[model samples]
Target: MIGLEVSGGIWKATINRPEKANSLTAAMLTELAEIAERAGHEGARALVLTGAGRVFSAGADLEEAHAGLATNPVWERLSGAIAALPCLTIAALNGTVAGGAMGMVLACDLRVMVAGGKVFYPVMKLGFLPQPSDVPRLRSLVGPSRAAMILMAGQKITAEEAMSWGLIDRVVDAEALPDTVHALAADSVGASPAHATAIKRMIWA
Candidate 1:
């Protein structure tokens, strides 16, 4: 499930199904894409994507994934929506991030992760490849060598390692994650929305 709320010039989208480690289902991915689109149309100055509990997301729900179906198209659309948002986008990684969920994280303009959290892409081990859109995004964040290491070598990166590798911008205590993200969002409130949007467009252009 996905939960969306807008306040203080920020649109927050939370992955609320903690019971299953917030694994994304087809319906949830659709909701996320819609939320991202709505946030842009609603004039949000910033967007934050995060999970409700200790795990950011375990990636696509295996059940749905194995049922002669593919959610990659929807997932790609969601990632594209986040990347194409005119406003700033931040991924608040309150917990572990794994598998296809890494695409969404990389699509964000910035990322703040909880200390001790882990990030891994298991596509290699699972006998698949990262989505076409995801490969370049990940490569851009950490460079080709490191990206290969993550994608081909199946390395599991820690929060500290992720920051060092340029996969995330900040790592904070779990308890401070929300406050830190809120502070970052609040600090951006003073910027001219037009200027911010322009800069974002140019950066991603």
Candidate 2:
């Protein structure tokens, strides 16, 4: 399940099926994409993607992955929608992130993770190619070799390592995570929609 909260020009979308390690289903992916699209169209100044539990996501749902979810186009749609948003988008990594779940994280303008969180993408081991845009986005953040280390060798990296590698922008205590996100979002949320979007465009340009 996905939960969305919008207030004061900020849109927060939470992946809520923590019992499943927040793993996504096709329907969930579709809903996330729709929410991202709506955030863009509805003049949100900031958008935060986060999970409801200790683990951000373990990637696609196991049962669904076995049934062709691994290669689904919905992954691309969701990430692309997030990437296209003019709002300041952040992936507030509540905890570990693995497999296809990293696609949306990579699309974000910033990634802030809990101090002990881990990140890994095991497409090579799983025999599935990542979403189309994910490759370049990931390489841009963490560089080619490090990206290869995760994708090819399936090496799991800690939050500090990910931050040093440039994949994660910040690593903070779990208790401080919400305040950190709010502070990072404050200026944009307080700005005029056009002003915030213009600055975001300039930064991404």
Candidate 3:
């Protein structure tokens, strides 16, 4: 399941299947694109992507991924939707993020992780390589050495480590994540809208 909330200038997109660690089904992915598209015109200055349960996302629905119809193009469409979002895109990584889940975080402009949460990249294990389209962002975030480790070794890095390595902007107590993201969004709104948009455009460009 996927959920969307637009309130107080903060547009939140959440993964709603805590029972399944917020895994992404095909329907969920389609909803993600729709939510993002809707947020585009909602006068939202900041967008927060989060999860309903302990885990941010366990990654793509494994069953869906294995079904062979979850084609690369579908993933690209979702990725494009996220990448094209105009407002500040913030990821509140509440827990373990893996595989395609990691891609969602990478698509965002900023990411905040819970102190003990983790991130994993396992594309190689599944006999595939990193998406060429996503490689640039991943490389810029962690540099070649760390990106190689994630892509080649499929290692899982703790949230604390992620902060230190610059993979995530901040690490907060698990319970504090929502408030932290709220504060961040509010801070964005506190800035000049013109300047904020300009800065965001420059950063994204």
**Best lDDT among the predictions, by candidate number:** 2
User: Backbone clashes per model, in order?
Assistant: 0, 0, 0
For 1-205, candidate 1 gives per-residue lDDT tens digits of: 7888888899999999999999988889889999999888888888999999999999888888776224458888989999888888999999999988888898998899998899998888887668778899998889999998889999999999999999989999999998999888875666988989877778878
Model 2 over residues 150-192: C-alpha lDDT tens digits? 9999999999999999999999999999999999999988888
Best by TM-score: 2
In candidate 2, position 72 carries an lDDT of 93
Cα error of candidate 3 at position 48, Å: 0.5
List per-candidate RMSD values in Å: 1.3, 0.8, 1.6
lDDT of 3 by residue, 76-136 (tens): 6666667777777899988888877776688888899888899887888887666556677
Q: Kindly report which residue pairs in candidate 1 clash with one another.
A: none
| lDDT scores of the candidates, listed in order | 0.88, 0.94, 0.81
What TM-score, to 2 decimals, does candidate 1 have? 0.95
lDDT of 1: 0.88
Model 2 off-target regions past 4 Å? Answer: none
TM-score of each prediction: 0.95, 0.98, 0.93
